[model samples]
Target: MKLFSLKKTFFLIIVLLGLTATSFAISNDALRQQLKLFSETLSYINANYIEVPDQKELIYGAIQGMLSSLDPHSAFMKPETYQDFQTDTRGEFGGLGIQIAVRDRVLTIIAPIEDTPAYEAGLKAGDRIIRVEGETTEGMSVMDAIKVLRGEPGTDVTITIWREGLNVGKDFTITRDIIKVNSVRSKRYGDIGYIRISNFNENTSRELRNELDKLEKKPIQGVVLDLRNNPGGLLSQAIEVASAFIEPGKLIVYTEGRTATRNELSARRFDDKDRDYPMVVLVNQGSASASEIVSGALQDYQRAIVMGTTTFGKASVQTVIPLSDGSGMRLTTAEYFTPKGRAIQDVGIVPDIKVRSGKVVSDESSMDRVSPSAVPEHLMSDSEELDSDNGAPEDDLQLLRALDVLKALNAFGGTYSRN
Candidate 1:
């Protein structure tokens, strides 16, 4: 939602480029001819048109047309469009709160965010959205389907979904809520520290560090890093997180764009402070981008045991280039790879353990609904506190499985401890 001051920065860059480049100069003759052609086209369009056109709309259309020729990520977003981006990334949108990705023409549910309306509505990991409000979504774009699903909070929207082995389409009348995605959820479950990351945002690294410090003071066994529904955020945050458990001087991730300027990133040399904790990272089809960067690097280095399904393969790095105007373009500038030099584009990281979230439920009866007081005294420490309610207690079977593994590892004294 914050406006970035990039006009001056762009102008400065242009000035520097002009000074550096001696041979590659724009000819005045060619520029004059291009301007003449542009004026002629504009005149022609204005003189012979079916309907009167707005000048601003024409300019926006031209910009949109140009951007459409580029990659899918490079888009011309209006003020409202930017607001939509903010709502989605913050996970505070007024909608079903279910992340969907279209593949094979079917809108499949990614892992629903914890404590969201969608999670509460019993949406599972692999449920297919067949219809919304009575309209068929057979040939709709992902963006269009998302728009139809979002509305004023407290309003109800009926969604028809088809899941595996289900002969009949399941209809869910879900209420729209002001979904605020709590990026991090941490608590001591028995001897292990359970950390659920909904997404890797700007505050993620700090949140994770604070949670770990709390757990470190107690009799902690190990930590379960749940990255199941995370769509990922800033690359810097991902590297910071991966550096916590991984050794210094290791390759965390690397980027390769067409230009040499936007190329490399490596891990630090001495991240020995938070390096002595056994970790199990939970990932699924929704874990992607910066999430993959952290999980893939950890998995390659054997720093953490990855559990759940394969990641949502998104390895492209976007560079936000602002124009002279307030609007900007988020262009996919690079392809990223894991530390072990594996391309994660379309090919995600395979977890050490694979567990599905299972079938979708329709009502609250399927959830366990653990209260804050339900966490036994043995489960909490002076520094650690439990969340008020257990999140999607039934649909989060993958997280439960990961916790079980961590508990077992603790029994074997495999929770990494430094001498």
Candidate 2:
């Protein structure tokens, strides 16, 4: 059986060499030489190694090395890891509830989901995860780190984090839980509508539509769409959210790859004209991917004014393809651009009006002091914690600026073209 396996492997290599000769520009002779060298190395390792090694593991490692050389986002996942990847889109998973990415070859926190153990523990965006359970995460992939960070509910793991302002890494011990993301929330600021999208998930579109339905019942002149600290999720949900405001069949985002010329995605939902009130979109350094798509598309169309700090700037599109062994690979096939051809890869969407982070304080000494209690319980900010929630302060500086601009737009009674 073992001899047969070795023969089959060499046979597969020969087939690959033949395919490579026809597909690639490299000379067939040189390519054949390289394949021969690889086969010899594998054959030697299998025969002369002190102990027998798992052939499956050896193959998986080779695939991972190849993909890792391409980009940080492209990775080879094992069967179990691929299963977890599917669960992520549903927005219900057992873990710390933080979106992470490998930026500059370091495991960086994109954003901590609200109402999760990680967010409540005060994990902020741009924080680097240095260690997990006392094990250094120095050379760990994002998927490996995720496996260690997640476990059965009620269990706990300690992660050491390093942030920009911190002198040294800090350790945080948080319990695992089934994080069910309530991606959309809303509030009313008098005549203005406030829709806060924490992240784009499968539930986001349905929830956002419901929120929009509720807001439409009221006479809202404008809306403040808050997307601060929102590490974006499913791309489909991003288009759906944009379609709530942008009319049908208009370009929302376009992607281009080496082999592919252009693939354009457009707003599809109808009845967007009714929600075409003057709008202000709120974003910050934590808002990325799908978040950038919606914000950039709106800005390009002049449909809304974006306010607050710049976005997190993740514009690469990852395509997950399954392999024969139930494992898979997430390959970075293309980079995405906004409708007006603005690239968002490392260059995040710049807000039309930049507002510094601050608290909005009315005349505290005046008799008209609006205390925290004065604000209705239902009208409270969507921030999980006051420290990390850039969009929600007692009275948010960015939110106030957005409302002020929307109010101004309402006063001007301007009419803009729809998709």
Candidate 3:
């Protein structure tokens, strides 16, 4: 029975090799040489290894290595990992609630989802996760790190993080919970409407439309769309968001890939005319993927004055192909481009007006003798006020800047109209 198992494995390997050779159009001689080398290496390891390795593990490792060599985003997802990934897209899952990626070969935090355990614990963007549960993450894949960080709710996971402007690495013990993301939040600043998007999920577009409808009830002079710390999600949601503001029949974004079937996603004519209000978009280094797509499209069309810092620049489109073993492959299948033909892969969207975030004021004298309760909530300093429910500080310097820009546009004879 053992001999038969080995023979079946050998046959499977040969069949896989033949398929690869045929797909790539490799010459018969070259294909034979490659297969011979692979067979010899397998035999040598099986015969001379100090400890026998599991055949399945060896094969999985090989597949992982191949995918990792292509790109950081492309990866082989084991069956369990694939299941967790599907759960994540539904907007509720048990985890740290931080979007992470392997940036510069380090496990880096892209953005912490708002109101989640990680965000409430003050885990900032660009923080490097050095250790998880005392185990080093030096050679760990993004998916592996995710597995360790996420588990049953009510569990605790300690992670050591190295951050900029810090002398020593800090360890944080975060309790996992079911993360439900509220993608859109809105506030009225007299005639200006401020909307903050935490992340793009399935409900993002609908939530944004609902918020916009509520804001439209009041007189709106201008709009500030904040995309700071927004680690992007579904591409379809991004398209829907952009369609809300952009004109019908306008090209929002186009993608190019090796195959023609999955390329080019253009904007559909969802409405008669675009929203004709002066607009400013706020973005920062944490804004990535779908966030970049929306901001890039608006900027290219001159529909909005993009403010704040540059974006995170994750412009590749990944497609998940399921395997027969219940596993799957998340492959970087295409590169997306803005309407003006600008590539945002590693080069992020540059803001029209660059404004750095202002420092939080902690001085008591700056309060201007008015009692905290007497002062209007929007007029109070962000540092002095905290959201009661989430305990997260509402420090939004970028939003303030966007409002200022909108006011300026409104003042100058309403020059920046959305035509």
**For residues 181-247, what per-residue lDDT tens digits would candidate 1 score against the true structure?**
6687787665567887787667777787787778677766678888887777778788888877776
Query: For residues 271-327, could you state the per-residue lDDT of candidate 2 as single tens digits?
Result: 545565789999999999999999999999999888899999998989899988899
Which regions of candidate 2 fall more than 4 Å away from where they truly are? Answer: 1-33, 361-395, 412-419
TM-score of each: 0.69, 0.87, 0.88
Among the numbered candidates, top TM-score falls to 3
Candidate 3 on 1-419: residue-level lDDT in tens? 75567667867887887898889888879668977888777766655677765777777787888898888899888889888788877878889899998888889998999999999999988899999989899968888788889989999999999999888889999999999988999987767777889999988988988898898886787888999889899999988889888876788898988984545666665444457888999998899989999999999889999999998888998889998888888899889899989999889899998988874557787656766788655444432322322333237567766766776676554565344
Instruction: Please give the lDDT score at residue 337 for candidate 3.
Output: 93
When 1 and 2 are scored with TM-score, the better candidate is: 2
lDDT of 3 at 307: 93
Clashing pairs for model 2 are none
Order candidates by lDDT, high to low: 2, 3, 1
Q: Quick one: best lDDT, which candidate?
A: 2
